[model samples]
Target: MDTASGLTYAVLGTGALGGYYGACLQKAGLEVHYLLRSDFDLVQRQGLVIESPDGDFALPQVNAYRRSPDMPRCDVVIVALKTTQNHLLPDLLPPVVKDDGVVLVLQNGLGVEAEAAAIAGPERVLGGLCFLCSNKVGPGRIRHLDYKKISMGEYSAAGEAVGITDRMRRIAADFERADIPIELAEDLVLARWKKLMWNIPFNGLSVVLNATTQDMMANPDARSLAEALMEEVMKGAAAQGRAIAPEFVQTMLDHTAKMKPYRTSMKIDYDEKRPLEVEAMYGNPLRAAQAVGARLPQIQTLYQQLRFLDAQNRGL
Candidate 1:
């Protein structure tokens, strides 16, 4: 699967995060394939368009595949599917990643490495966290709101079996050339958890209150609830022996206050009447609290309310 010069990457989901990185890589002259669904007809007909505060980009000649089997085995595969759709990995990934290929997940929450390892093997699975705000405006268009850093690392202590470190560096170099900042981490679990610390509060509370991050931060009650939930998360992290600073929660809250008016994906899903990722994002943290013998009554309460609301909305 090794390329002659540049690397070959297959982006499994051409949503906001995946599409942004894929567009950048393709523009950098790297061989990149986008595994898209039938809904991407407009993208196939015209092009993949990205509108960012930085600039606007259109990738007209980028290779797009509708079927997995039609794709060539790649040196690396970047997975950006939603948590609810993670089960499709076994079916969608095997055809695009060779035995020696690496698979990096830019997903939210934890446990994605283990899930991906079940399909791609431990040696081929890498963990990544994206710190960007983007939304799919339409079939072929994505809007990048803010931030563009991608943090990635090997999932296993043994590192990548197929020279993944070098390949990762090369991928970062490609991103850098394309004006996207990419950071490599020695400990991916920390990166995942750190990002989770931000997502769990902002995403869950935003959906619960039906508000944007700015709205959540502006309300004293909601902001206090989010801070308490974060404290519980910090306790869970501490029980797992991960040293977390006490001011971390305040830092995230302060940062959110200054960010543009951005709504979380959970809020978007609720507005669209689509299923939410309450289990992986909120339920799992509460379960982690139980496992660590930590009490997170506030988050637990919010989780229960959201679960009930979800069921009521679904008529279950």
Candidate 2:
């Protein structure tokens, strides 16, 4: 059932991003259904708790469910699943999203929206690049760290020609009304690549060296490696016919230097005995670069290291 606000929202993965965004919408008076896994029972009873530097709040009652099929068809389906859990979407998305529903992918890595487009059709898919640092510290608890802005773009199967369709405007309106800061992107491919400028360096390096973003930036060698990785990402993006500004590399570096000392999501996953998203975060970008006749040696070495590391201490 739609609220007076007129959009029924469904959250596919009720982790940090999903829980935080879904709660934002719900608190703003929109109807949002959260499909939970490990925290299903606790959330169904105690609801969600959000810890943000801006302010903290608790939602004591949420439309929480454990099964996807039990969710109502939604106007907007925000997918916050880690690229690691994307395998479940084939069974989950079709029933939860309405015919004209838009599926927003809030994930890390490149070429991820393609998976959603393949399932929901290209026109129905949208890419959302999240620039927030939040973590599900425990069942029903999410801690929001540094930034919280999302850059959104319409998805195309061919990954060509970006524009702002009426749907994009409406979705942007929906997000804005919920007090979530958003940016509209004319080129989805470029936005994805720009986001990669940060992910490639920090996410993998933090895991491989067992360091935080600040640690990498503070160390001379690690800082140099991060800059080199960012350069390769720009080259790979250009190879794909999408050019991200070179200045973005420095921009990301400066921003991360000022942010709080925090562990990346991939590092957390590795530390928690869960699967690291090597393929989605590192593997996909590597293949994309290779497909475009671009070679990223630094990224390739990082990928191999992550693959081996994932194979080794994953049980911890």
Highest TM-score: which candidate?
2
lDDT of each: 0.79, 0.88
Off by over 4 Å in 2: 1-5
Q: What's the TM-score of every candidate structure?
A: 0.91, 0.95
After superposition, the stretches of candidate 1 with alpha carbons farther than 4 Å from their true spots are 1-5, 157-167
Backbone clashes for every candidate come to 0, 0
Clashes of 2: 0
The digit string of per-residue lDDT tens for model 2 on 30-143 reads: 889999998999999999999998789999999998999999999999999988889999998998999988899998888888778889998899999998888888998999
- Lowest summed lDDT window (length 10), candidate 2: 1-10
- The global Cα lDDT (0 to 1) of model 2 is 0.88
Quote the lDDT for 315 in model 2.
40
